[model samples]
Target: MRSPLRSRLVLLSTCALLLATLSGCDDDSGPTPDAGSQLPEDSGTPDSGAPDASTDSGIPDSGAPDASTDSGTPDSGAPDASTEEPWDGGYTVLEEHGDWIDRGRYAPCSFNRQGDPSTVRCDDLSRYDLSQCSPEALAQLDAYGIYMTDLRGEVPRSDGGTGLLPAFAGFMLHSDGGTDTMNTAPLDFRNTDGGTFFIGSSRTNPITGTTLTALAGCQVPSPGIITGCYARCINGSFNRAGTFEAHRMPSHRGESESSGGLRLISESPVAVGEAVDVYVTKNHAYVVSLDRISGTSGGLTVFDVSDRAHPLFKASISLPGDSSWNGVWAKGDALYIAGNDTGTLIYDISNPAQPEYVRHLPAGQFGVHTVLVDGNRLYGMSPDMVTLVYDVTSPLAPVLLQRITVPEELSSGGAHDAFPYEGRLYVSNGFGGYSVMDVTDLDNVRHLGQYVHGSFAHHSAVGTFAGRTIAFEGTEFNGSHLRVLDVTDPTNIVKIGEFRLSPVNSIHNLILKGNHLYAAWYQEGVRVLDVSNPTKPRQVAHYTTFRDGDPGRRGILFEGTFGIRVPGDGHVYVADSVRGLLILNEL
Candidate 1:
């Protein structure tokens, strides 16, 4: 599940075999980024200081069961289908929690020594005297107005900590002393479209843009700064109220931009459509591609990487009726390919180069978007939000053990991928959100908790860092960033830290090894971060994979590094959207 996180679907009638069209271009000639500034390291856990588990602060209580959903039931209905809507259908109306933002605490301006603007902790826009601003600053403000955007708040859970609510605002103050107007980005709360709620009239134009809210008590304390409380509540159905402070311009420009750690070790081209995901074994690397559209076929291309510097294209497999393989993984001699329409396609890799087709699991028209193999169990995540667990004790014949279902409320599009640790299953539930389940007992697989932010297309990687079970989750969307959550207590999940490049570049797959996180960031290329201190992730290295002038560059949103694998081989394998397989020395 890479490109915008969806199952590769093509009408069976239009299936046609097409050889991968190769374009001649210099892969090694890609420019490396210069060492950029680093973000301030943040530590310490957020003390869950909310009043109570069910703090009904003027907001509608989540105590009542939503009418649209089954009553707290798991595995109760057919997987919810997803339309093109970015929300993806499964949205939980945040229980009304009246005005949780503490304006006083964040109002006093305090500049950090590092001077990193984006750090909300150091975000203090209270000192500027708007009346004393120079004519130039005022003119820029009068024209563009002060746009204070990126208003993010938290939606507390019934347990303890909170879920992230994505919200932003814009305001324009008329210089003629006429009426000032404020507007909000369409808020989709738990699937409910809370159309642009009006924030109040106080406005200011800072160095960057305008900042204002509709909430009546808001104030333009000085100039270019607007402080006020805002809430989104619809007919007492949902509510998430918070205080926000917006500056005219973004504080973190260029602070998060950096390049360089990855050096090209080797490169190989796959004559396929969109080289999406790749998996590596001792002697070979298996790369998969997605079909351009529905009709043409896209299949697997194998390369013998035993010779690291010069990987030879060994064999190519293109099935007549079954293609569109989105993911690839291998355990022992069996290769598991995520068959979009035919469940899990198993191939015998006893002979690495020429893999023999074994069979498809759960035979029939089923879409397996991703596959994860742990010990003797193989977990297949289907697009319908159901995970089929199989006892892969025998490589050839996998026995279906049990069907693990995502909670009905959170199972919107389906389960994108799953990571297993101890007795728990950490799943990246596409539109439903991120979930932690006790797969300890398959029969009574209970859901512990979930973290559903505004962003859909949540794909992930989980690992233990600093004695806490931290999951590095990224969403594949225009503004998606890497969110670090402490899953030690799934019931009380806490967001410990976050990392981002440009909001426009989407994050795909993340591989966590020890204290290092290898991220395949679309457009930004391959990024390596040091997570030794999970609370504040630091970007130590990066390799830019996308070039605006590259040959066959489709200029699409989901273009760049699609898949990445770190098999403890001291090498990083990445699947670039245009460059095919890219091998870099481990940072």
Candidate 2:
């Protein structure tokens, strides 16, 4: 249940506008939900400003390691050189099979057309062939965890042909054999151990004002893998149908809950909304969250982290009517917070435990999704397709320098986030792709080049590796993974390596410390990759932060770790949507 004030805040934040640009929403036909929001649990809207906490390029000046010290050998927890081989950049890539099934002709289920989802029956097992399903093997699967399925199938096109459509779904199987799909409980969930799986759920489309029902059935091809088909009906009328391949996210590739030497030190629950990002400075950590549908208000949660094994709650602050704080950064005695309603919220943290509100910059309805500080310059990424540049030499009082905007052709998707490395600004422009800009001279800011990938460009971290400027970019959406690019020559950016987990999961924010790249991947948890070999990124360590019954576990696409910061500290700080602030031992 969302409060009226929050509802108004969502509208004022211009989330719809940001979604329209990032997703290319058709204005005339009404809004089409993003791939992650197709399920009921998702609000189909970006977090206020869609910012990632800890979006800074690297550790700040506050007693953190500098870039020059990042060229050391691999961390202690790296994979053994004798047993593990470097990745060849080869991984399973989903593709369309060009096969189509006409559900209207083969299945007895028909659209109700009356717009009543109750009349549509989805329990007809006769529609699928059970010969290939292995009941014995399925029954042996661990049935009490989370699974994310990726669907890549062909749908009927109006031209009497077929078109490819990719979809993603998440489900939680409880220890009691009960199942929940996308947070929709008591669904028509059934499974023969693990051999045959089926689930049906319904939701009302906010745009079409019609009920949409989805039914999925899969055969267990092997442990942790399910192959099947699904159908979506709108107003009881068959709208789309497709085949799917599901994979269990935990213990990937025979790995356990954790790998290498990464381990959890302590867990602190964040009472404020959905914890998204965090920053560490002055022996304190600042976590920012966004208001969730579960009715929690978003704000800042401060913790005195003087002791690595335990963190003391210092304070929690939620402004009346302005609680959507997404990103946080600090310098000197001034702390900068990315406020969706008010621009950059400045706080005087001279009293480390208590943050006194100083003031918000540029005043009046400025929405900043993420903030980054480099030297004396502060970068605020806005969903309005511009990056706000401010001079923060004075720390507390920042002076607006300019609003950098890319060309119209490359600005369709607004600037989601950016990373500064060596006088160059690598901007993750959603939909428009990744753009490299030269900001050596603010008055003459120039666009170097752009990488036009197909997904929504979200956040990135750049560093020099083996004499080459390497960037690790992560996109937001189903099947999005880490893409390691060689940006030595901005005009010709080439992908040299990549790392992937379940396609159903996503990587939110990441930081590069020396030879290690730490990523806060939702559901996949905290992943530490050894990128000493820029061409082959290998996972050296990991800590799983997602569990079955964690509070605010909605079983949606973006429900796990959202923000991560290394800061060269002996500990890793993460902001989990459910578990809140998690402190882990750094490898």
Candidate 3:
């Protein structure tokens, strides 16, 4: 009995052979005898008779294809009829045949190999056809049915600048009739040649209610890996273009990576459903749980990790209405938690392990998505598009200072995360853009400059290197990479560098300590980069925390490393999507 893996490889090889022939056997080995076998030498009209001996297209004559003969036109001399049914042996062909969805844009964006714009207006996939695909190409598609891809591209703004954003996408080609669409998941059919592919989709943006469409041209460099260029169109106008790459999601019994310099010393699973972030203070670790999907209760879980090998769960705090806790930070003896229902849930962690809930600041449904602490200040991002500043001189009580309103356009998308450095607060205003604000005066917060690119900005970390203020920002979606920006002059911030893994791998939370940048990059796991040269960021080390076989690992595409922390403890603590709290020693 042939294993599934073996069967897929056979299909890939067959597809490669068919496509190679159709393309004139461009490989170095030279053309085959029947290189242009599909092309007819003549229609057999009286003027163009006898199979033109002078024709140099390399196509051989299959007897004489007499279009005018008494007998109807003969075969174009295609090989075996069985091969024509590409999926007869081991594949299932999709039956549904109809025009794919096409939402036309005035000028569609198209990108070049360097992730720069090649053409502002390009063709859509409507003119593309899978029926022209070779048998091998069909087999290759059957072997790689449904998969997810991470997309990164720039959205040209009205102001003449570009916004680089991350987008999550999937490709689904189903044998069943209903879902044959492309460009994003659960849909089907992108054009294919051997393993090279072109996938696209058109839709209406739910937030802005604007028309949006995406098209990607990709090639399977390996059996399960795809790399490509993507173009995005918005509101009937050409936006921008970028590059993308993805790997097939690992199977249930997937591959594994042993820890290297980063050694897992201790680990524990949260009793709550999804453990998102962790904060370590003194001897105890405070982990926050998010009650996502379908859940009524979510709260904080305390673990005593005094021992590096084993951690003990101490206490859990869950409120009736306030359950979705997303972010956590420690200042002195106080622990500040960002709550979706309640504002900042203040806790007295003077006793480290035993935390006592004090009060919720601003006191109501504030919808604080994330929180950051710097000295005596507390920065909380409210989803309604404002960063609420508070004086936390007294750990138990937080006095609200000011509400800095984000621009109306960005604020509509909500504020996702914030980072405080020097006198400037770098806040990711959801899909609004990246803003550098002057929070020096809590009385009157001012927006110094903004990096509005693309459509999404989720999290960022900043630092000063070589006399220049550099910001390392990462968006949450497919194709998101670490973008390095020189923000010394907030008004004219320039993009200096970028680092990317697979397009399907996303970047979550990142921390900049000294010259090393630590990030919890979704499926690519924990990446440690040395950004000494801001123009070029180099990855120094990595600790993979995602295993496909891990308990609740699904195929939603975003399941992997969720959070990371490096608090000068000589250890890196990560909250993995499935493995829970993982403690590692950095290299």
Candidate 4:
């Protein structure tokens, strides 16, 4: 069960809901609150009691060219063909490097020598040398699009030491010349200002009652790439100063919305709060949602997806006072839901379209954020930094096996999610880093080793490629991309390759099907990469599911694809934040 202290921390973290300017709870924190208008679960009724059949969601389309019109070939930017043989256990270990773009030195400016928010002040030009800033390039920026930025820099700590700071920001430049940011309320751009190629935004932290401000004196280092110095102040005191790189997220490398035959089949809206994750089983799609930051409720929304192109709404269920359902999965006749207020909620889905509620596991105030089913074993990751193992040999009834906790859980974050491959379990242990555990015997689970990347380890997909055990790991933060690690030797895991989109967005979940890696990238949309070579991942196909004006679009970094499932049924099931369940044709 979730402790009272952890529950309080969860509430306090939600106070700062802006993903761009403020950090929120980690993956284990359960359903995150979104900054959007509150609507009843039953609002915006679908057509004929089912999702609208239109491929378009009534909002503006992403304007990406149709992939069907492609010439049936990989993009020119794809990696060249390689004839390397399968891994024979001997290979070069690639060293990782910082993702920041360094542009020489900057003129330093002092803030409140004393740690006082009331003494914060903005030093726009004096803080950074702007002689290299190109107003012309900034002016050429797309007047109407969203720019997501990833920032990394150093700040003076109270202990007389320098600390590294990583942050994210989002800017929406309207076609009408007005600008907006995720730091402010949705559609409210009044607190933002920009001239030429520079942009700045300021807001008061309602939770802490402190003044927060940021200024970006930028230079267009390249097309679609904005890099420069930025200063942030809180409560009239200098909080941190850093270098930033912003990427225009609408399109990638001039590619259209889709490529390599991947195309959208249907888009269904979820009227129950903000849709985050989905599970497709027994010819039915089960989507779970979370309450928005506006204090709305979220629950389960079911659909009859027997028809790939048109999904019929079957049922919507929200508990009276506990409605935050973040993850969903099904096995046999059993359906499992990760509930914030409750543990794993079991349901009998023998009827497929109509599910019957069973009982909650470990009853009481247990917080299960995400769940995984491997054979007859069920893994429920809790925000309390513990992974609860269950014997689900009888799918309908689960028996608690044991609680697995890693040393990093307490100091880092908690158990966010896990992937069970072979006799090993790859755990995305929040800030605790990626942990590889020998779980062949749950009774004597042994810690293999851990890869402590300084990013928020969120989700991963592992597979055997060319006789090598490769894991595609991803973090959840601005500028967070995909890291390809060779984990065959868990103790000596090494990063062999990496794949990235815009730094402003984030990679959420990964699904490895054969040699293809399907990812639910938040703002960059659904990305399909060919990882046949593992080290050199190539984008073989993509489908953009995010549009600026989509319904439920909020001023939060996690505003696009959240959950994805490729069931080998020639269809891809996606749970998008705004558009709900998106059915796409598999490549």
Candidate 5:
């Protein structure tokens, strides 16, 4: 496949060809033999009446053609087909039939023969039927800038009908009714040359002028000669940040990138904080984002919570990892991010647009998994099969107080996520039962307990609402399940209950606000669960944003919504694998 750039170039070249033909200006190669062929052999269907030899135009002699010819009355506006013969040998036959002959000085297919030499060269023949020209222009209608084999560029007939060229190489139409219309993919000059063509959002060939090159080496009527190249192209709007129009998404539904099948009610209109790893909270709002395609990493978005009617993005803090960001938690002005390889990063977003990096946690961790701020205690999971607890009573400095090593054999330790509550931290070990840890003392840690019934446990969240401890872990790889655990009694963590909100699975992340648990379910999308009861959770309603539409559409939901949380108000955010951060309001 030609790169997207090449394909677009071809399309434009073809369009130019169509325009040239309509304007009666054939390429220097002239039209094929019938177009400017001076030889008699090409004057196949010779006209009966010969052109008066006195005429300067060197048209082949076909006997005077019957006045009623296919190309219309011999008006000066159009070529005098009546007197022209299809043969190029200059012999005029008495037979009256449909044929055409060329009669002008020819221009060589002029081009920079050797790099940049000087002025282009020109020479020879003025007429040749499309079939008798150089392979460059002969079978490749696009060669002479002829868009299609059909006579579309022909002088518009008085009947308001159009003439069309023949399909690719089968020049002689076997019969009438054989023209392919524009509906079958517009002919890009490149594509007509058998090159692959790039399609725009509208599927129209968006080739521009400068990019199309006349690759004369290609065979006429053969594949690769015309189909224009389909190059891999990225969807980018020329506009830079702050200037991005809402039209950024594939409004026309063209081929887009691989997202979590979740549609963005609004794809991150704002690029920063896109991979929303940074969490910010204020008197007004909370939010996250799916960053931009540029830069090695994306960032976290902060919102103004001062007013519910309008939640504006107040700041964006970038993560240090060269990879995209994953999770974010903010305490006061300090923000913690799950930096891909750079480990957990702490930053002071007090100066948001210009964040000040504070400290970096240990490495070999992925996802930083999940983070929680309990007073001065900081808890986070490292993909390395270990969970770390930190004492951050000192704002600028965080002391790594403890690390509990969990055996990989005990838990896949795909140790996806963890969150601290009361004095215990609930850790969701991928494929491992949730592990409970006691961190009453930041420096001292103890295994409070664990629930070993295999829970998909990719991530977990703890909410202290109504004086009760409700811990949630995303278990269903593709369903909406707030794996509710009663952690009120930390020493004995129990999977008291679970609330399944939708048929589509893929429960990725969940966050509790007030009495509700905002679950970012992959294909099942984002749902608001009323978790007033630790043992039972119910969904109030759902906003069908742009999720995979339904969970497990194909036995498995590929549209992955990883992080879901409601920073505040009616807005629920979901980070999609395909689409960055999807911001939406609950219905």
Candidate 6:
């Protein structure tokens, strides 16, 4: 038997080789941001922070087409699936800079940062539901610079961290912990009369004057619907964030969990549910797929998996009115989750199977994205892109202690994932990269430093065990790579090394198991690495869960893959575009 140290080394070596092979994939460019109602007519009003009355909805306006989404052909652009000059081509724009730069067309959409302007063409915004099209319509939702709208198109499943949800036309698929697609529901972008859930550029934009080609040219979707996905596509600019069309989840009747087989599952659309997240105990694992129905309390599902090969249906718990949700963490007797719209929710999951709501703390923004509980306080990032600090000492009624606005220039008002270590908070500033802030003064978390070049840095994990901090910044469009920084001294941060694997450009979530770091490589797959040396990171073992071969019989169809940690377990939970939830052991 190999010693623990040798085992870790071997793991690192395997992960390195796999990462090397996958480092060649990609996120869509974020839309122009900050063009909120308060800003001047031309000045973009991106509201990545505190959504106020201005978060109201409005009729789609026709300014210079949404950035690079348009070609030089102006509003009367072509209507083909493929373009002759690449639609928005010739210009070095963000397309050339890879994920490092967010290139746009003329006027550069709303926020207008990328220097490249559309020659004259325009973007297609027809597929997104007018209601859900505003803020997120043009915004890049994931860390890998992947536009949330990307989900609007295809759902291609592959391996590593990216795979199709375990489903078959409105049905949830269930399996053991090996299921990486803990996907609750499909993005449901098919607002059309009777079209498929997936949207396509084949459709034409009736309003933008630009054709389908014009939209895809700039890497955007064709004009359409996004009831639950439209207008809310920018920072602080939420004209609409998508309508909540409650649909009863089709009841799934199949073999009981006692049978070692996979099943399809889904959240009841009409019923409110608790926040969605994953948690772990010494050797056990569980996923909390919560729901915050529009106007009702939420619910949760507890999957008991003492047997890695088989997860038993433990218990189901309900919480206060539909409290929207996100990231989840569990302490002694309580499970804490960032309830997107409901604030922070705490539940008693000591029973492993059955869980009960213990406490909750409302948040500033309507939804909470990422969260971290340090000592007695819980730190949450609201969808409005603000940091909300809560006092969790009183678990029942957690007090809202403070909320801080990230530096405008540094964070796009969007805070995705964050971790507090050594008197400081390290936040993944969405498209803004990784930021180190001094949260010692909770009320006033000072910006200690930042790593700005990583583009759409979605999630980060600090190697506290090794006294080192590492940022797994996601890069789409080929610029995606792992940026390792030396944060021993938060004030003076530096990028010591960047690990890249071809064919696998985008990286989502990562966790350090023992001395080896396992990462979810978007299209590439799951990667294990050796972080023995913080400054110099290396790869080890890699399992292409969804590669063409379909070795393990797990879902191989990969969509935009995202990743996360499974609490105390040595395994990691990777979220595939359509896959339900993937549970990978730390072997």
lDDT scores in order: 0.54, 0.64, 0.55, 0.64, 0.39, 0.39
Residue-wise lDDT of candidate 3 within 1-587, one digit each (tens)? 01111101222232234333221111111111110001000000001011221111111111112111111111122122222222111212222111111112112223532222333332354332323333443346443344555445455568999654443454545444435443322332355555546655554322223323344444444566555566554445555555544456531113345322455788888766467787776667788876643343557888887775788999888887777777787766788888877678899988877898788785334478777776677778776667788887886787888888876854534667777777888888755678888888776777788876553467777765545677777765544566677787888776766666553445677876544567887666777765545455656556667653464543444456777766545566777657778888744
How accurate locally is residue 362 in candidate 1, as Cα lDDT from 0 to 100?
Answer: 58
How would you encode candidate 1's per-residue C-alpha lDDT over 1-587 as one tens digit per residue? 01212253221111111000101000111110111112231110001111221110111111112111211111112121111122112222233111112223222221122222232221122312223323332223222233433333445678998664434444433334433434312112111012211234222212212222223113444454444444332222223444445443222333333344357889888866667788776468888876653244567889888777888999888786667777877766788888877789999988888999999885334489888777677888886668999887786788999888887877765677777766888887765778999988888999999887634444666655434566777764434567777787899776766776542235677776554567887666777765655555666667667543355543334556888876645577788868899988765
Kindly report which residue stretches of model 6 are placed more than 4 angstroms away from their true locations once superposed: 1-211, 214-276, 282-284, 288-299, 316-324, 464-479, 489-492, 502-505, 547-561, 566-577
* Candidate 2 residue-wise lDDT at 570: 68
Worst 10 residues of 2 by lDDT: 40-49
Report how far residue 556 has shifted in candidate 6, in Å.
14
Query: Residue 382 error for model 4, in Å?
Result: 1.0
* Per-prediction TM-score to the true structure, in the order listed: 0.60, 0.81, 0.64, 0.79, 0.48, 0.52
Model 6's alpha-carbon lDDT is 0.39
lDDT of 4 by residue, 1-587 (tens): 01122222343343345333434221222322211111110000000011132121111110112211222224334432333343344456787653332333332322233445445455444445556566676666665566665655567669999765455556666666443554433332232224344456555444534434444545665676677666666556666666666666653546588766788898888868678888777778889987665566788999988888888999988887678788887777888888877778999988887889999985334488788777778888876778899898898999999888776543255677888877888888866789988889888998998987766678887766656677788876555678888898888889988876664566788776555677888767788876656676777677887676664454446677888876656787888877889999866
Residue 389: error of model 6 in Å? 2.0
Clash tally for model 1? 18
| Candidate 5 Cα RMSD after full superposition onto the native fold (Å) | 30.6
Summarize candidate 6's per-residue lDDT along 241-309 as a digit string, tens digits.
Answer: 111110111101121221111112221111223223444542334344433212334344455455555
lDDT of 1: 0.54
Candidate that scores best on TM-score? 2
